[model samples]
Target: MRIAVIGGGISGLVAAYRLRQRLGADADIVVLEQGGRVGGVLHTRELAGEPVDLGAEAFVGRRPEVIELMSELGLDDQLVRPAGKRPLIWAQGSAHPLPGRTLMGIPSDAESLRGLVDDATFDQVATEPQRPLHWEPGADIDVQTLVGDRFGSQVVERSVDPLLGGVYAGISASIGICAALPTLATALDNGASSLTEAVRTAMPAPSSAPVFGGLRDGYGALIAALTAASGARFVTTMAATRVARAPGGWVVDPIGAVDAVVIATPAPVTARLLHHVAPVAARAAAGIELSSSALVAMALPRETPLPDNSGILIATGEPLRAKAFTLSSRKWPHLAEREVALVRASFGRLGDDKPLFWTDEDLIAAAVADLSTVTGIPIAPIEVVVQRWPGGLPQYAPGHVERIAALESAIADLDGIAVAGAYLHGVGVPACVASGTAAARRVATACIENTQR
Candidate 1:
């Protein structure tokens, strides 16, 4: 049996590696990547003698896909975790720590509201139990409204919205709550339920669960390891322009024929590739919406004054020059040998949709200005690196899961072809890895069954 996997991003690489392991010399597996390098959105660079995470950073430790996959690949010794610190939300010209014992910014326990909320706002939220009517099914909960109703406007606008903005790059109102945060949504469905109960049930005891860790050098190392271990044929910068059906298999045009194919690129790119193989599927893939985002990393001299902790987030309501900043030096001691600080600024989102067309120079300038405001330093950036992503991240809107369900059904009738990526399942790194592994298994099993027959 022969198989073709399009795109060399993390998802595609994982799928190809698994295929090589399962089929070995009996099957022909090849990977094609349009770009000069792999890793997709995962990009890291060393500038001014410091490591900067230009793309995806930490993976959720709760998810086992990344950890298990790393262990299998013999990367267990490279895992390490930095000291943890509290995250602050900057709003109204001041930085405020988020309230604790809260689920998605909703205070479940009254004590959690301590100094974060005003008396009037607290009294208003206390009236949630007095409402005359109960919520009905399919009643869309505007995230802003839900946060304000349960806690206060301060919490919603200052903390919740800004944090969600960083992830979705879109407003929280239109984003699907269940899709973005299923655990919090499930808890809400169980009744505004107490925060204590939610905490006890929603997350496993901290002592029982393993802590989160990242590659010792960086995430880029993980990608390099996968590429080296995959013992399959790999061709870079060879874009698959067309795909057609041939006798006993499908022919990925501009290339040759293959028993099966896995299209693991982004939605827009994937849609274009599927245009000929399944026109209907192409149309559906094109309908999924995505936003653009840019990351500007600046390395300041050791003389630069910065906070002693993790970093600061310019909340939605803050009058800032940029969205957020992460103090890399404080968070990760190994980032630099000297006392120099690495500050990262995130730009672009709905109502702030300007970064999509920003020039590299402009982005760097904006980032420095925001840094000056947050740290009270007027120093210039010693080194700057700007990374822009066209369709930043996927925003799963209402009934989005259903739309994906229909898309899967449309492709079910097609032979020897399957799709997987962040677009199909969850958008995190671990989820993408899981999707790739699953696709490899499905195709491998089908190939074995056909050979037996």
Candidate 2:
């Protein structure tokens, strides 16, 4: 059997690796990467002789899939934790620690939230009458509406919006409350009813495990290892312009043919690839939106006094050039040898373009100004690099789940074809791997069914 995996991003790589694991040496596996190198979003850059991650910085801990994969690749020991895992919120002209008792900005601890807001606001939040309503436990709902109803518009706009911008690079209004955060939605459905109560109930159990971890060398190591194991022919600078079905399976024109295919590229690219194979699916994919973002990574002199926490996320309305800056030196000590500071200034999101978007020089100036306000440290970056990702972050708009389900249904009817990436599932490294793994399993099952037939 022949299998061709499209897009050598993490998803494509995982799918190919799983095929090798499940189908053994009998099946021929090929990975077609449009880029010159693998590790789509897992890029690592060097600054002042120290490795800096420009793409995904860390994966969530306790996520068994990422941890298991790390162990499999013998990259577990390289895992390092941030100095203080808690991220500070930059709001109200200052950087404030994320209030305790909150689960992703939802009040898990009402008392903790009191300190975050004024006394009057706190009273209103705490005494806010729970409107008479009934939502089933674990029932899906819109997150933005849920937050505004349970908490207040203030909480959502001031905290939630900026936080989402920091991590998802999107507007909270766009992200499906249930799909992006299922547990909280379930809690809201339960008698916990209100946002504060639901947050307290849904708060993650305490664990000794670290909250975040990154490779000693970098995430690039995992990408390289996965690429090597896939044993697929890599083609860089060759963007897959189209995809179509061929006899017995599928044929990737100008590339080759295979019994199966897995697309692991971004939403736009994936949509373009599916246009010829399945117009409906392509259209559905094209409609799924994404946000633009830029990460300005700078290496500051060790003498700089960075923020206390791992990083700080500015509030939605806060006047700043960038959204937040994660102190890499504080987060992962090993990454910086000297007193140098490794800072990542994230800028831009949907409906907000204050990143001073233009040349890297302009972007850098804006990021520096934002950093000055948040960190109170005025220092020039010795080495700075700007990575602009246009429409990189997928927006899980309202009714996203339904659209995705419809798209999946359409794709299921097609033989020897599969779509897997962050766009369909959670937009993180773990989710991508899970999606790829599932696709690989599906392919293996198809191969078995073909043999029986």
Name the top lDDT candidate.
2
For model 2, how does the per-residue alpha-carbon lDDT over 195-265 read when each residue is reduced to its tens digit? 66667677788887777767887888888788777666677667766677777787775577778777878
TM-score of 2: 0.93
Report the poorest 10 consecutive residues by lDDT, candidate 1. Answer: 192-201
Candidate 1 — number of clashing residue pairs? 1
Model 1 lDDT at residue 438: 83
- Please give me the total number of clashing residue pairs in predicted model 2: 5
Q: Encode model 1's per-residue lDDT on 1-453: one tens digit a residue.
A: 789999888889899888888888767788888887777888778867645568777777778999898898889986766556556667767666766655555555555555555676666555544554344444445567566555567767765676777666766665675576666556556764443343335543446453455666678778878887777678888898877778877888667989888888888888898888788778778877887788888888876777776678776666676777877777665663455677778887755668757889988888887777776779588888898877757776666666677777888877677788887788778988998998888777777776777
Each prediction's Cα lDDT score?
0.73, 0.77
